[model samples]
Target: MRNMKVFFFFLLFFSLCVEFSRGQKEITEVNVGVVTDVGTSYSDVAMLCINMSLADFYSSRPQFQTRLVVNIGDSRNDVLGAAAAALELIKIKKVKAILGPWTSMQAHFLIEIGQKSQVPIVSYSATSPFLTSLRSPYFFRATYEDSSQVNAIKAIIKLFGWREVVPVYIDNTFGEGIMPRLTDALQEINVRIPYRSVIALNATDHVISMELLKMMTNPTRVFIVHMYSTLASRFFIKAKEIGLMKPGYV
Candidate 1:
């Protein structure tokens, strides 16, 4: 009976040690949050790329002690939805880093949440120059700011000798923030902006058609369109229906 008791005690000790070692090994897991509109084509592609890159990275560095665990949250393409997603990632998932909330409007709130949580928010698609003024250390942009593209747009206008242009953009932070720089760039080259047309991100097809028709009534044939690809696709579809893709349009 004495020998059997000792044997059971030793078995228990061995089991505890094994469990402790397994727990220690699992402590190397790092949780990362991906917040984006999964409904969009851009984010669908981005998620695939991220998964492939992570797989390739882990395969290439098999000896690495740390492992990354990805947790995805769909922002649903809205400000409140983005904030809720970020909050869930930070509070519930305890993610160390956040990658995206694709638009500037979404990024604005996520940056604040990241700052409060001391988590880094990395954005690859939010390109508003307005975001730069916030100067939050927790916010990191992997993509070019909208201001950076203004010069390229200006060059195009100059090349075509388009004296006047109309700016057609979505009514959101991403669209609003880019205009000041774009307007300044166009003014530098003596190009005039006759009017500005704003379309809501969630605008219906009928609304988009109306806006296109309003734009068509004007004499300015050249238009500078800046918005998310999803909305931009709708805008172009309506523009095509209105014959804006013809030779007269610059």
Candidate 2:
């Protein structure tokens, strides 16, 4: 993950405290907080990556005396839970920085908390334009911004010579984050966005079918899908089952 590189670079900044670390012992413990939805596939994989990256970082730089002590907190996939976790990490754990909380929504509240506590909030996957718009110096994005994908989408649409396209996205902050930029990019290329397919995160099989049926009624077959998180996989499965993933559509 890109975050691993960012974390590795972050170690250089931690080197500023090397003297403080050396004063204490040969190996200094640098506490870093990781907040995320604990049981999710992404979270589990990311945790493993973080551990592996740290191991590699230490093995490569044995001469360095500072070591990151990762302290994890479960956000339980809720906004309030994320805030609580961040607060606990800052107030009790005394973590110098925090890693994640998964989504843009969770990061929204945590960013303010990080600002108040002077802790750096780094996210690798929260891609909402709204997050960057906040202009919080304490907040760092390890991944591309949501609007950055508009250029690629525009290029694809132009190459296909599609006049009209629909945006099929999850109904959430992360999914909606790219719409304005995507619409503007399409408009610049003289493309019409006939409709937006706002699929609910918890949409069932019937709900997905109803949405697909609605799209079928419309003439626009080309689509730019930006569904968020795990919903994208389910949405594609339903679209394929409904025969919408054929050669006629995108």
Which candidate gets the maximum TM-score versus the true structure? 2
Query: How high is the CA lDDT of each candidate model?
Result: 0.82, 0.85
Cα error of candidate 2 at position 22, Å? 5.3
After superposition on all C-alphas, the RMSD of every candidate to the true structure, in Å, is 12.5, 1.8
Candidate 2 total steric clashes: 0
Residue pairs with clashing backbones, model 2: none
Report model 2's TM-score to 2 decimal places.
0.93
Write the residue-wise lDDT of candidate 1 on 1-250 in tens digits.
3223222322333344345445354536667799988778888877777776667656775655566678999899788999999999889999878888788888999999989899888887788999999999999877778899888899988998999999989898988999988989998999999889999989999999999999889899999898878899988998898999888996
Please state the error at residue 98 of candidate 1 in Å. Answer: 0.8
- Kindly list the per-residue Cα lDDT of model 2 for residues 83-176, writing each as its tens digit: 9999999999999999987899999999999998999998887889989888899998888888988998899889979999998888888888
